[model samples]
Target: MDVSIILILLLAGTLVTLFSGKAAGKVALAFGLLALGASVALLTKFNAHQNIGCLGVWMENPQIYFALNGDGLSLAMVLLTTSLLPIIMYSTFGSEVKNPSSFYALILFMGFAMVGTFLAADGFLYYIFWELALIPIYFIALNWGNGDAKERQKAVVKFFIYTFAGSLFMLASFAYLYTKAGNFLIGNLSALSLSADEQFWIFLGFFAAYAIKIPLIPFHTWQAAVYQKAPTAGTMLLSGIMLKMGLYSVLRWQLPIAPYAAKTFMTIFIVFGIAGTIYGSIVALRQKDLKKLLAYSSLAHVGLIAAGAYTLTVDGLRGAVLQMISHGFVIVGLFFAAEVIFRRYQTREISEMGGIRVQAPKFTSMFMILVLASVALPSTFNFVGEFTVLYGLSSINIWFPILGGLTIILGAYYMLKMFQNVMLGEANPKPFADITFQEGLTMGVIIAVLFFFGLYPKPIVDMITPSIEQILSYTHKL
Candidate 1:
């Protein structure tokens, strides 16, 4: 598994997809299939004990390396990104975009940036990819987004400034760490010693970046608007894969680099996360616009994932990783469902939709499965992750789990309400079409993966546990 191939293929996909003109979606899907093949090869070749690389010595004086590697943690994320790319492209096959070429090109480029972020083993390389990931999405939203021109501009610009500013803080912190350690390798940074106060400051700097990316609580003002305005593909990128970058950063960078600070402020971070969970759920309950509702729902779920990370226990960390994957699949499916409804009715308001189930039972059934998964029903993938996270929270303190558990009740209430408004009740008088074959393929694939993992999660649990344990050991040693 030459890690470089994944990046090259994605970049090539971007160019080929762009040049393919009106068939850009098909071109992108072809490239995505190729990339998935490469990722599968990488997964088979990956050895958790050794850092695999096709290139090295990217810089001299700074001693940076182009050494792309895949531990279990990174490979899982890379697989997720590659797996979703084709589905996302396939979902767009029937649409007439303003510029199909550029639209699909940006999506492919976004995939490259995200894969780079996951596989990057050097600190500076990680930052480069982190900032690079933001660029494509910004353009996607700014150029192709829905709603008023001025409003979309404001939302995209605000998202840009917010994430870019946060990245600067992260860069500053990394620079300080570089000066102290004289290198930018992740291993070196993790091994460096810092005083409690220094660790606290570094932690704060990283927190600003991750929090904004995760968009926890007060820092989340940019998310709902940006998510609502971005074109569905762009929004899928943001919610499905992008948010996990922040949560993944916590496990990969923040906790290990600033162990004392992580330990010292664990309670505060958990409390803030719980607050975001409650706040997001409550706000979602009132949202009339379906996109905004899912956006807020994402906020709530991610908050719980972040809180689980702060728990610093095996169950918590594993649950966070598992839930990240679950949320990625389920949320993408849900948003795609939203787009399906919008395509038929040309409206995103819940009040405007009714009795879709009567007209499109296949679509309705799939949507119901995803909705139930989101609400964490038993025998579904989300249930396993949520249960583990709750168990982790309970291990820390009973009240923490108790408070976070409100998500179960709130999740069911809001999700069921949204489903009832959009899919049930008296049938709409307007003619409605059943799910198209392409749409069914997309939804069917996602639903199948969700069900498979729900019943047998041991494979993923086995792959990620060692990396999570390694992270825990490093934090504990400090």
Candidate 2:
């Protein structure tokens, strides 16, 4: 009931906002706040030791349960999703984005799908919500995206087809599991006994979807163009939260169901993830477009996160979740900064930008802080997560940490280079305005979280540690 309330509020907000016409953005913000309130209520109940909520037999012949269970992991993700919605909505205030009603409505719907994905306990229900998320984002990108029509169309289509095709493999795996377990419940699927061969195929099936979504190395070709073409809001949804869905699925679905296969192929997955870390960093260093640069930066960060999870160590899983949350906040802030830049300077090319600090010191300062965080500065939230991940990788092999840690140097190099080129040069003749009050609030909230967690990460680490232990226990038994 508590979790469902969040979804109901969002879906209801979607309808209300659609009907709100010109006032849709305001309505959307209001609903986002309400949903955030519900999220708070859920957390409160969780703290007070109350049942969060669960409703089963809610869907099809195969059957899917609608659950709002607030385990540590789910609660953390719920909080991330709800909190980001209002901030994301607020970032759009006073802007003219064609049909404001539809745009805001899609944002709410996208939140609904993500929350559902986080809370779902039934495999079929999880799959449904997972695919449901793609719909809103697809339309969001297809309609609101900025670029040449042909380019936008190509990017959106490729993104859509790539993700959808990957999902079919997951669906097939779920069907096979249903046959083996006689139900679609996650518990049953995780507990079902299977041979090494069976586990290998199942793991591969899940990996297909996850790899495409995470877009690890060879699978990531579609991401840069799609991110560059999409509007800033759409880019945030994709980079900030949507991509995490893939990484989260690896923890929630892949490892548990196919522990043997996961163990068997652990090195393969880790190598790919580390390869992506190095590969994405190299690509990012060369990007002319700021959005594309950040997109590749995101890829590199998530690569390390993925590598952490594949380690199957408690520290690795813990680090992965922490990084997911931290990355979500940081990436959104960075993308918003990019949007703010685009709004002011009318270009995303790093070559065309310079002396922003002279013109807009406030913007430069905030952007610099975010960049520092992304580079895992010692006092930032990312530092804790990145350090933990490197530590986790080290357990597998000292070399693993050594290789994966390249991201830190590469990240700082590209990030500082971009910042120097864009924010620290001679002032452009045209007046470049500093961040407005709204932009400041958005970036400020994110920075505050990063700082707070960076200094004192024990609360989140404590909350998620037991859950990480539970997951690691499953892997150990296998």
Candidate 3:
């Protein structure tokens, strides 16, 4: 079966959804399931040894080849994207969306772009899909967001402009590489050599783009506002899946293609990652809003993943990939829990709620599990990633891992504080309800996966190790 069919199905689903009102959810769900199944089949058929293929030539330049290829790395991301879409769609059931068709249509369209981002082999094609993924969510957030209309619009615009500015630098970096390699294919570019100075500038351009997308410290001002204001489903997609694109691109494009510069500037880059970790955690500690706190915490977690990738060890790379997956689940569960609380109380302020656990034991229990996972508790998926990442960093610099380890304490402090304020303190004057069956089921699945993978992470480790090995081999050659 042609992989292009996946894109076609998504486009078709979007169109069908826009016209069909009540049937929109069913259509979107069916398409999402089919896409997931197809992605699994593709993964099953994938050959780890084969990493490149051309679907056709898109332009006169041989560089602009239309291609779809996957090795272990791409397969992992593809599987992750496909698997999560169905769950995200399911979570949107009976949401407050009035234009359900358009809402579902945008989701289907976004899925197409995300799948393409993971699969596209040419630099130019990849950029197109990369930018394409942002549009649907921009509209989704602007249209469906909570809060004053002016504030939501401002937040969405800020998010769009910041990310787009970063993307421009990314395009410039790709163009610079294309000038030398005369090809846009990622594989060919990885084989090309550049002087240290040239490599440094190119790396900076790539880093600028990725850092903003990852929203590392100083680049992160727009994120918390957007997350706090955006609709819950939109926020889920943004934090859960969209953020991974930045970390993944660092592995795919920056580290492999510019090893000399990466080696030269590794410390500086790692410093930024560490800064983001500490800054995000400290700011989160001060936030009174639950969603904003989770937003800041997400920033801190991704910083660790970004730092792990910059370490350039197999363990670092593998941990970064695994953590990306783990963080996705943890953030989704966290925000969903926030949504449950907000729906019951019509508020996100931490101080307004108290003694929630006393009234809602099931919700509190689920929330506690997610908080533990976020804090990288023993036997959680987050712990596996964090441990490997720190171990990998220890090989680079003794002090680096020591500072990075501080996140464990900071993470626990902020997460537990938020949990206690919402769940453990004295009961609120206004009553709140317990979790709904749908909400419980959604969170339960996420926590179960977190526990399963946390305790037995060997399978993911095995799947990602080969790809990390391949990346490391490329760096060694350079």
Q: Which pairs, if any, clash in model 1?
A: none
After superposing candidate 1 on the true structure, give the runs of residues whose Cα lies further than 4 Å from its correct spot: none
Is candidate 1 or 3 superior in TM-score? 1
Candidate 3 weakest ten by summed lDDT: 45-54
Every model's Cα RMSD, please?
A: 1.1, 1.4, 1.6
Candidate 2 TM-score versus the reference? 0.98
Write candidate 1's Cα lDDT for 1-478 as tens digits.
4788999999999988889977888888899999999999887876767645654888998878886767788888888999998988888765668888999999999999999999887889999999999999999999999999999999999999999999999999999999998878888899888999999999999999999999799999999999999999899999999999999999999999998999888999999889999999999999999999999999999999999999999999999999999999999999999999998888999999998888999999999999999999888889999999999999889999999999889999999999999999888997679999999999999999899999999978888888898899877885
How do the candidates rank by TM-score, highest first? 1, 2, 3
lDDT of 3 at 18: 87
Candidate 3: which pairs clash? Answer: none
Assess candidate 1 and give its lDDT: 0.91
**Cα RMSD for predicted model 2:** 1.4
Q: Which ten residues in a row have the lowest lDDT in candidate 2?
A: 44-53
Evaluated against the true structure, the overall lDDT of model 3 is 0.86
